[model samples]
Target: MSKSEYNTEDFVLDPEFRKWVLTNDPEAKRYWEEFLSTNKSKIQEVEKARKILIHLSQERFALPDSEIDLQWNMINDKIDHMEGLKRQTKVVSLDSWSAIQHHKEQSRQKRKRNFIRTAVFAFSALGCFIFAVWFQSQKFDDTQEVELSYETMEVPAGVKSNYLLPDGTEVTLNSQSKITFEKNFSGDIREIELVGEGFFDVAEDSLRPFIVKTQQVSTQALGTAFNIKAYPEEPISVSLIRGSVLVTNSEVSDFKEKLVPGEEMFATLDNSTWIKGQFDLKQALAWMNKTLIFDKTPFITTVHSLEKWFGVTFTFENDIPKNLFVTGEFKDESLKNILDGMSYSSRFSYTIDGKKVNLKFKP
Candidate 1:
C-alpha cells in the first residue's frame, strides 16, 4: 500500500518506523521526520505508533504472534456470527400469526442486546490500547512518572561551544561553562541548568516556556535572545537583548522581576535581593563577538577573566596592587597583547610560561 494509505497499525508494524521510535536510529529518524513534515496527515498516526512502541517496550513484553492472530480471528468470527443472525429471519403462516409475532419480537430483542455487547467489547479493547499508548507519551506527571534523564554539555576553558538544543533553541556556551537539559526536552517545560556563562536564542514555544536555572536565580523566556553571566562567586547577570523575560530569585519566594529589551537583572550571591537596570549591549554581549571590554575593571578581575578566556593560571609574584584598574577593549587579540595593553595602565609586568602566567608589580 502507498504511504498515504498507511494507517496506525501499519506504522506500528513497519520495521523502519519501529526502529526510529524504539532505538532512535539516526537514519530512520531523518527519514520519518522528513516524511511526517511533508505528509501532515500521517503525523497523528505516526505519533500514536511511536507511543505504542514506547509503552510496549517499557513493559518488557510484546504481543505474541498467536495472541494477535487469535484476537483478529475472534473479531472476524463475531462479525460473521452477527451477519448470520441477520439472515436468519423467516415468514410464518397467518393461521398462527399471533404466536409467531410474539416469538419474532423476543428474538429481535435478543439479537439487539448481543450486537450491542459485541460492539462494546470491540470498541473497549481499542480504546484501552490507545489509552495506554497516550499515557506512556506523557511526561508531565512528576508525581507518578519516572524522572527524566538529563545530559550535560561542558565547554572547557579557553574555547567556546555552539549547539542547537532539542527544541531548536540556539545556545552559545562560554568557556568553563556547563549546561544540563533533558535528552529530548520531553516534559511540559523545556528547562536547563546552567553554570558559568552562556547566550540563549530561545525558540518560540508558547505551550512550553523555556527556563534557564542558575545557582541563585532562574530566568524564564518564551522567545528571546538573552545573555547570562553566572560564574561562581560573581553576581548572576541576565541581560535581555530582545523580547522579554521573567527573572526570579531561587532563594526568595517573593522575588520576581520582569525584564525588557536592553534591560539586565543582577543577583548577588550574598543576599536574596536582586537589582534590574538598563544594560550596555555592546559591553554585555562583547564576549559573543570574540571581544572583551573593560571599563576601569579591577586588576584582579581582569586576571580572572583572562584565566577563563585563555585557559591559563595566573600567580602574583609579589604583593598584589591595592588600587589598580585597567580599561580596554580587545577583539580576538592574543593573550600577550591583552596583558601588554593592561600593563601600561596598571603598572604591572607579566611573564607567560605555557599555561601559567606570573605577574609582578613595579614599586
Candidate 2:
C-alpha cells in the first residue's frame, strides 16, 4: 500500500488483481467504479490511452506481411515529411559530411541549417518514445478503472442453458437453477455454489479438485458428470451419472458418502438425515426427460415435487389422510389430469387457482 516505490507495472501484474478481473468479482467492479468516479481528473489521459491501446490490441497480432508494409510506410512517410518541410523553410547542404574544408566553399549559413535538419528527427524519436511509455501506462490505468461484474443467470422451465466455467467445466443448468462461481476458480480449491438443479460435466483437473456446495451438503469431484437437486423446499439430492463423487455435510459427525454411477444421496431437512440409496438412473432423472416418475412416493411429497418441477404452488385445507402413498409415472400430463388421478384414489381432491392448487378431503 506504500506509494514510495510504487511501480504501476507490479500492480498491473499482481496475481490477485488479475484473478479478480478474470472472475469478474462484484467487489472488484464496485471498487473500480468508485475509484474512477472519484479520480476522474487525475486519470483523464487514461481514457484517450485506452481507446488507442484497445484498438491496437484488437489488430490481428502477428508478424504479418501487411504489418511489415505498414511499419515501412510509416518510417518512409516520416523521413519524406521532414525533408519536404526543410525544403520549404530553408535549404541545407547535402555535402556537409563530404567536406568540412568545402563547407567554407559553400557557406556557414547552410551548415547551421543542415545541423538543424538532422536534429529534427532525433528530437521527434525521443518525444515519441517518451509518449509511448505514458500512453502504455494510461492503458493499464484504464483497465484498473473498468468495472466488471459477474452474475449468475436463472434458468426457467421448459428451457435449459449451457455455460462454461473458468476452469473449462461445462454446466447445463436446469430450469430454475443457478450456479455462482468465484472469479478465480483455480485458487486453492475450485468451488461453485449451486441453487436448484444443474448437470455438471466437469473437465478433469487433477491438481485442483472441483467442489459444488449446496445448502445441506458439499460434493467433491476430480472429474465427473452428475445431477444436483437442491431446491429450498425439496430435499438436497445428488445423482452421479458417471465417474465418482464424495458428498459430506459439515454438521454431521459421519457425513461422508461415496457415490458412483447411477447412485444418489439425499439430505433431508432438520431432524431428517441424509439418505444413501441405489436408484434407477432413468427413474431418478426422469424430470430431465420431461417425464415424472413417482414410484411409491407419498402424495404430499409428490405434490411438492409437482410444485417445484412446474413452478406451481399447492395447499391443503381441512383434515387429510396421512401417508396417502401416491405412486406411478406420467409424462407431460396436464394439471387437471394429474389432480383427477389423485382424487380418483380418494386421497385428496384439488382445485387450481392460477399457478396454485388447493387440496382438501372429499366431503
Candidate 3:
C-alpha cells in the first residue's frame, strides 16, 4: 500500500515508524514530526503506535512465543465461531427470495471484510505488544549483567585528587576520601556515595538531580557547587558555594533543610538535630586551593587533618592537651613546616618516623 493509504496496522508494522518511537535519532524524529504535521488525519494512529512503543520500552518482561501463539489461536477461533453463528442465523422469505438472498450475500461479504480488517488490526497490536515485551526482557537481561559495574576513586592520606564525572560535574576529593558511583550513571538520578570529604561543582540538569550521600546525611543539588565533609568520627557538614542545595539526615527522612549560598548545614551521625549557619568559604575550601587554615582548631582535630593531608599516622606519647587551640594558615606548605609553625605556639615536640609522627609536651 502507498504511504498515504497506510492505516493503523501499517504504521505499527513500519520499521521507520517504530524507529521514530523507540530512538532519539534526530533524522527519524524530524521526519516523523514533519509527516505528522502534514498527515493530520493519521495523527491518531501515529499516537497509538507511539504509545505502544513507549509501553514496550518500559516493560521488563516478555511473553513466551508459545504463550503468544496460544492466545492468538484462541482469539482467532472465537472470531471464527462468531462468524459461523452469523451464517447460520440467516432466514429468507419465499416472496422476493432471490433479491433478499443477493442482498444478504452482499451484506455478509461486507461484514466479512470488516471483520478481517478488525482482526488484522487487533492481531497487529498484540504482536507489537509481544515484541515490546520480548525486547524489554532482553534489555533487562543485558542490564543485569552490568548492574554491579561501578567506578570508585579514593585519595590516600596526605594527598588529594581531582576528577570530572561523565555528566561534566567537577569533583575534588580530599585526603583519605572516596567516592563511588555507577560506571555509566544510567539512571533517572545522578548519585554518588561519599566517604570522607569532597567538593562538587555539579552540572545543571533539572531532570536528573545530583545527590551526594554520606554516612550521616544526603545532600541534593541541581547545577550547584557544594562541599561535604563527613569523616567517620566527626559531624557531617555541607557547605554551599554558588548555588542552592537540600540537606537531609540520612536517619531521619523528615529532617530536611535547604541551604543557600554561604550557608553550611551540619549534622552529627549520633544525633538527629541539624544546625545551619553562615560558613567561611575560604576555610571550607582551603584544601581545594592547597591552603590549610586553622582558626582556633582543636588539637585532636588538627591532628586528624594533618594525618590525612600528609599521609601519616600520629601517636600521642601523653594525654592530649586540654583547652588547647591552634590557629594558622599554610598555603602549599610542607608537613614539617606546618608542624614546626604549630609547635612554636602549642609547646609540643614531634618526632617523625617514616610515615608515623610521635607528639609530646616539651618540658
Candidate 4:
C-alpha cells in the first residue's frame, strides 16, 4: 500500500475537521481539499464518515410507498440503538453503549410494570408490539403519491440495467447514473431527478406530466423518448427523440425554456444558468448504444464520470492543471486503456489500482 493511506483518526477526534464535513456548505470544500493532502491517522473514522457522506450526497429516487416502507423497516431495525452500538465500536468510541443499555433496561422494567395490571400481561406486550408495527405500516399508507417519474440510476461499468416506472415509462440505465422521483409522480407539478445519463421512453399520462429534475434544471414531457446527460460536475443536457419536452428551472424563476424533439437544454448548479440548443439525438444519447462520449470535457470532469459510471477513484499528486480539457470517447474501454488513450494526446497522466486511478501532472 502507499505510504499515505489517509489516516481516519485525525478526522474523527479533530472537531475542527469533523465540523467541516458534517454540512453541505460549499465553504467546507477548501477544508476537505486540504484534509485530502494531510496525514491519514484515523483510518476507521474517516472511512465511516466518508461512506455516510457518499450516501447522503447520493440522489434518492422515488420509490413506491410499500417499497419505501419495507426499506425503512430494514433500515430502522439496523439504525435503532443496537446497530448504532455496532457501528460505533467499529468507527468511533462506544462508551455510550452502557448508558443506552441502562435506558433500555429502565424502559423494559417500566413496560413490564405497566403490563401487570392487565391479565395475560405477556400477551398484552406482544399485542402492543404487533399493533405498533401495524400502525406504522398504516401510517405510511396515508402518505401522498405522484405519477410519472425520472431518476438518476447508477451501475458499475460493464453492467447495464433496465427500470420500469409506474407510468409505463421504461428507462434503460447506463453505468453510474441515478434516477429519483416522487411516488405518485403527479402534483402541483410532475418531477423526477436525474444524474449521469439515461435513455427514457416515457409512458404517456396526460393527467400528470412527466418531469426529469437534474442538478441544473427540470425536463417536462407528456409522453416522449429522450436522453438526459446531467452531471453536477458538468452542466445538464437533454436530447429528445420522439416527443416535445419543456425544460425549466422553477428554482430560478429567471431561467426557463421549452424544448422540442431534436432540441436540447443545458443548465448548471452554478448561478442557475440555462441554455438551449439543437442536438443530434444519435450522438447525444449514444450511451444507450454502449458508447461513452466526451467533447472538450475537463480532466477532472471525466474522472468524476468514470468514478460514478465505473465505480473507480482517481487521486492526484499535485493539483490538476487549470484549463485542461480532453476530447475523446470510450466504448467498453478498460480503465487502463481509456487512461492511456487520454494520455496519448499529452493531456493527462494516470496510474491505476483496483478501484482507484490516480492522475498527475505529466512530469
Best by lDDT: 1
Counting clashing residue pairs in each candidate, in order, gives 0, 2, 5, 32
Write candidate 2's Cα lDDT for 1-363 as tens digits: 632233443333344434434554556546544655665553333234323333333332334577556655666676667657866986445675656755664586456545654576466554554455445665543335333234465787535678887666888877678887755442446788899888889976544589999976899999999989887767788999999999988778687889999789988857277688877888766876777788778877887777766778878798667767877777888778877877888556678988888888876
Q: By the lDDT metric, which is better: model 2 or model 4?
A: 2
In model 4, the Cα lDDT at residue 166 comes to: 47
The parts of candidate 1 lying over 4 Å away from their true place are 1-143
Q: Which lDDT tens digits does candidate 4 get at residues 1-363?
A: 332443333333344454454442345546554545464454334445443332222423234577546654654454455545754765433478977876786698556544543434345445554454334333322133323334434655646689876445898876766777754332334567777677889876443578887765778898899888775566677787888887777567776667778777766768556567888765686667766788888877777767766677778888877878888878877777877887877456777888877777765
Q: What is the alpha-carbon lDDT for the whole of candidate 1?
A: 0.82
User: What ranking emerges by lDDT with the best candidate at the front?
Assistant: 1, 3, 2, 4
Please say which candidate is ahead in TM-score: 3 or 4: 3
Local accuracy of candidate 3 as per-residue lDDT tens digits, 308-349: 888899998888768999899999998889989999998989
**Stretches of candidate 2 above 4 Å error?**
1-149, 156-168, 183-188, 253-255, 347-349
| lDDT at residue 354 of model 4 (Cα atoms) | 85
The 10-residue segment of model 3 with minimum total lDDT is 139-148
**lDDT over C-alpha atoms for residue 150 of model 3:** 73
For each candidate in turn, the TM-score is 0.67, 0.57, 0.63, 0.52
- TM-score (C-alpha) between model 3 and the true structure: 0.63
Q: Rank the candidates by TM-score, best first.
A: 1, 3, 2, 4
